[model samples]
Target: MERSNNTAVTYDSDMQSADLDHLELDSAQKKIGLLRLILCSAIGIFVFFVSVPHNGDTEIVFSIIYNKLVGLMGNFAYWVLVLIIAANFVCHLYYKYIKKGSCQSAFAKVYDNDSVLHTLLYALGLVYVVLYAMKVNIPGFEGPEIIVGAATGESVMPSIVLGVLGIIIVGALFMPFLLNYGILEIIGALLEPLMRPLFKVPGKAALDAVASFVSSSSLGVLITNRLWRKNVYTEKEMVSIMTGFSAVSIGFAYLVINTAGLGHQFVKVYGISFVLVFIMEMIMVRIWPIKKKKNVFYNGHEQTEAERREDTKMSLSLIPKGCTRAVKRAYIAKGVPSEVIASLKDSFLILPQVLTMLSAIGVSGLILANYTPIFKWIGYIFQPLLILFRVPDVAAIAPSLPVGIAEMFLPVLLISGNIGAISVKARAFVTIVSMVQIIFFSETATVMLATKSPIKFREIVICFLERTIIAIPLAAAVIHLFF
Candidate 1:
């Protein structure tokens, strides 16, 4: 989720006798809070019992386990089934601790109020329950086509696994900010000067680059957001900096790409494309040259009342101190209430745009499904572009188009379709494209949120179009010339 411009506020209707605004939990909850640690340890033990083959791909193990089970207990679904069991256990403990003792965290306070994490966990677990309950017949998942391969642990185990994974992921994502204030202070000091000359923008720091490359994009955006709020940057500079890092989260770049179905080539193309995009925007900033009419312009004339209150709470005393304070500040600024608002907005606002994108791609895919015609089309598209780089038509479409989304399983798809056996060139194309991004949709929310620029359909389309114009052909050449 994007960081909110507004400060994080946890409304506390459950105030105590002393009536401190910060509504801490009682002594019992604090003492029993150790249960979360216990649950995590339990999950760790369960993971060991399962003997999960954490081979880069668990398909063989998962599929074989799927074949052996006669009932849900012995079934592959049981692992995920455990998620629901574990979640319930954890939730009970969470509630018990809060009621019994002091709840220290504002995150814990807000978790009590908004129930955002609970909703996601419940929604995810319920998906498994509903799917298995319907238990009709399909080959692998035992569901209808619409719900095909719908990540059935169709058991609670998947849910539990996700819950654990969620804990890991949230910690990883949240930690840098929790721990990196010293780095930021150092970065803001050291990198600001060098940043200007390298990017030709007045001042967005190396911190932006470090954050984008090493951690989450939301964090990099947060840093930029802070600078903007403090009036350290002009309006156009904000746009340039935001665009320079339109992609977010090293998680997708590293974990999902390298560790998942897509392999090394995917990583290379995506890394290169993003690097190019960053470079191009930096170059483009020099070309467009932000003409500032005023000394500065923000989304408004002044920081709003909400912003003022949150800032005061953060700097003065609303936040608790420790290894977690900066994260709490940033997170609270983009807290539960605001997350609810943004998620709702994205669900509604992004629908039509998603439908439009899907529709256009669907039509094109139908025509391009024929290999003979598709190759001809690719030749026509890339021949002229290839001339600019002194290369022949690479005939490799993977790097050139937004195929990441379509061909995530291109290796499997090609193996099934007999495409791999037919031609070396086609195999190369599939490999390269699969290695790159999975189009922008799977990543739509992140991509849209990464930018401070207005993330409307038209603007996104325009930015994507700019990349498509060059990215694909460059990829084709790389594939042809190298692998």
Candidate 2:
């Protein structure tokens, strides 16, 4: 009996020891897994954000690939893009507006206004199809010619198409890595304190702003919408980022500079615009209309767990924890192919809206600038302001200021040769202002109106006016200081 009791005790001790060893091994394995995720994620974030030379110019990897694809495909690529956009417009109009097709009943009921708007866009697309693709000229339609030429022309349309393509590729191939792998979470944690206090937005917004700067403003808005949908941002926060921080892409800035005859002074032009736009953003976020927006997150989840981390503390483990979270996210996220398709779907949904609305608004804005005295009357409001800055040719320059609403590029185009009349300082002033205007019907405005964000069309116009009112003087001050 004594020997039996002793044997039982020994068995229990061995079992407990084995269990503890197994637990330790499992814990070590998890740590190893987390470290691996952190390393892989860090590599991905670096590649996407870092710019390198591709064909003798520096840009991000995605831009290099997009430019190559554009070079390889050439005009055929634009034709394909335009056709795809037109087809989507027609289908959306027919299924959602004309027939109210039950196949898409769920989507239709939710986006009735979108369907109605798309129907009108379909008509505009048809006009452009006739004008650009078919080369058919209609009498009394001279107003649309410039827009047609601009949209389908060698430079503008190609750039727009390439931008979308880059989004499709990058969003598909890389976005999943960043979003799923906790790269955004890590960056958000690091930047959250700065972003939230200063911008009243989550640190995740830093990604949107960077994406927009590197890719396109349209891409930035798309990202903002995604963040909003995912419960990461409130409607107000998304709108603020979309409108304020989502400036034109670096590529577009380069185009703007080259077009404005400031290519030789590219560094100065871009640097000044960048500084003034940020300054304007700081002021705009605290002002009315924007400040009035309700700061409510999607699904009412205001404080995410990651966000609750005491931002004041810094630890080496934060990065690994971020990566571990990213790994879990990436695992939950759909595969690369699905993500790419989703990206393409987003592009399709937005392109028709951009093409249609840009056509109508751009044409009208151009017409008003060219044929009427409307802008001239509006120009008077800025005349005194421009004169205050000592910008020469105030009459000619003031009219161009209001035309930026039609398209940011219009102001530059309107003032093209006439810029010689103004001092180089004033030329710098106008160049920076046009880029900072932020409200242009051609791309950004169209996308804003198409979005489900609560910002109304009137508010967008008001914001544009507000941006101009603030940007002009600030730009003038910077130009005078530098030039």
Candidate 3:
């Protein structure tokens, strides 16, 4: 309802620290990263030789990833063993030499309690493998453990390795698209032209287009917010622009949804989201046409240039690495007592959080797989829903919304397998919905925080309904034409 709009990836891990500047010491997150690296890397390798194809129809491309991890980890069996030492090395460096609130933000935040590495690694979803491998099941989310049990078949190593491959391959495939390119090209060109026509906002199209590429929606939103404040866009423009722009959060739509059995819907979900946004923006432009008022022109949604500048300056100052830290440290370092810095260990919590996430994902995957029949049955009832989207009756499988309850990346997993199960038409339906923005809690939070806007819980619900309404037909078309 407020000014809506959209950037590139900042680490999902770094999000927890948005409000933690008050804390002095860097985080104490360890072990969890190590375990994550091991389980996922190993599982990734397993995916290569076993479930994946030999390039025939290429149902899944397994070995392509397993070999890569073997190279990165040196040995699949101890991927975490190596990753741990590496993570500790970085943490120790931060603990020793780095002085927060005293130096450049990009370089300084590295040592600050919330290191950028945490964000990147956490985004990878490896932590899920470790917790499940250790049989740690989150009380409410028992699904992941069950998935691990099923994935590894009798051996956790096989399942863990397959999972490992899944996480890494997914991470690598779109890393650049997820991160910023500074010169946005392919995707940028594709989505940018719509800005002036749809939202009437203007600036770098590619920069904001990162939202479409990766799972971490927050990163893209932050970038857009910064641009908006720079006066790159008008307030109404920002809102209207994002009408089509704020499809699904890439993280949830890609990483989480696909992980559940509905992984195949990636293209379908994303395609629908894109088409809907484009349509909405065009409609808004036609209806309002950016009309001018008799006196000082304004829409209920517009932010004054001065207000825009002020917000932009504050956000830029806060987000960047150098000045913000200098200012914060100047105040804290002067008289806060050096002893407080020494006791800062209590504040860092990435290791535990990672552990929680990893356990939840693994258990959730296991449970879902164990109850595959239940899902199939659910698919039968949902066949009507698929029918609405023009999904073929023979190609039905319930959408993969369950993995979110336990693991974040489970959505990606679901897309990989079941999408191929249905007719190409059904597959297309699944792919588009899977990619449409929204659904994932992580994605929802990213949009809310980055824009500093008030998007209600119900707003997301409405967004989903609108997107789904538009997507069903598009998916059907893809199936009818291609498959």
Candidate 4:
């Protein structure tokens, strides 16, 4: 009898000790998470947003680092890009042909899923890099000046491609600091009221916007698509968020502003563009196409009015609620090192494919802009609007505006040489319009189509035109008012 009593007491004591250990561990994890959330978020902000003087110019730390890296590499950067494209081509070939698309590895899956068109684009990218690097001109094709010269190849390889590669690599490496931590959770929780009503999306979508803002638009689309598949959002919510919220990153904004020769006005250009994107999105969600999308979940069931009403209800005690959610998220976050590695791995898997697309589409768009009259004719459509807005140098900046549909940076590339002809406000106006017109085919559009989001190609095209039309006057007004 005494032995049984002692055994019961011992078991109870053991349970108490284990409970105490669990409580202490939970408390410790919360502390670590809070620290990580604060410190890592600060680091991310400093890297991406804080501007400092470097080499006679004030630039964001991200750009400064990019410049230094470019300077360090010198002419060798061209070969590095070529090698990346080459690797992309070779991997796709292996995955699709040799492996017969049977590989299940993440990298293999990404490469193997490429359509024939994407593979061909990768091949074209390879050819472009080789031609540009060797400065070789094909006899039957356009001359070196057009094919490999300053207007097309030179503009693309050295400027856009390299910038993208550097940004993706560095940005991906540092992205976990912003995303995996608890800052976004806090922001999401606090902004739920405003986002739900204004954007008709859950507050969690704010994270997608910030992710796109600090990182890239494709990342934002990926996040939105994933959420939709998980039934966290309905089809209407997904389409609205994907089309409206996937904005250009700040890093890319810097590239555009610099390309437009308005690098000195980085703060003003980005600030105005950032505000204009949200304004455009707010108006876009209320219009056709997006507004017309059915409110069905991924599995095809319609979202009930009751469910939507629950989602739209605004909490009265937002601060406390936000903090509670943030603390829970922080408490559950993985270690920083693991999060960063995972982020970089994801970035690298997509990097090869994205860079290849950039090289292929960026060069193709620039070629069309430089050598053909198509964009020029398209420019005439917007000439009246430019006139109505009283924007200077309409003829020069007009062609640039429509070219943004091909690739956002093409407009900047087209007008970059006309520094003397185009006025500063005109250049800034074009820059903002290109960014706010977010349906460029090179990256964002391609990624969107790749997802199973039920968005048609025709819808994407119409949205592009609509956003372009809306953005032009709004951008022009802001430029004229502020600059």
Question: Could you give candidate 1's per-residue lDDT for residues 99-157 as a string of tens digits?
Answer: 53356453233234324433443443345344543453333546542232332122112
Ranking by TM-score: 2, 4, 1, 3
- Write candidate 4's Cα lDDT for 352-458 as tens digits: 77777777876786788779999989999999999998988888889888888777888888888878878888888888899889887666775576444668768
Write down the TM-score of every candidate: 0.43, 0.80, 0.40, 0.76
Clashes of 3: 74
Which candidate comes out best when scored by lDDT?
4
Q: Which is better, 1 or 4, measured by TM-score?
A: 4
Which residue pairs of candidate 2 clash?
Answer: 180-330, 181-326, 182-326
* Cα displacement (Å) at residue 334, model 4: 2.0
| Model 1 ranges with Cα > 4 A deviation | 1-182, 200-243, 246-277, 284-400, 404-439, 445-453, 473-483
Arrange candidates, best lDDT first: 4, 2, 3, 1
Q: In candidate 4, which residue pairs clash? A: none
Scanning candidate 1 in windows of ten residues, the lowest lDDT window is: 12-21
Model 1, global lDDT = 0.37
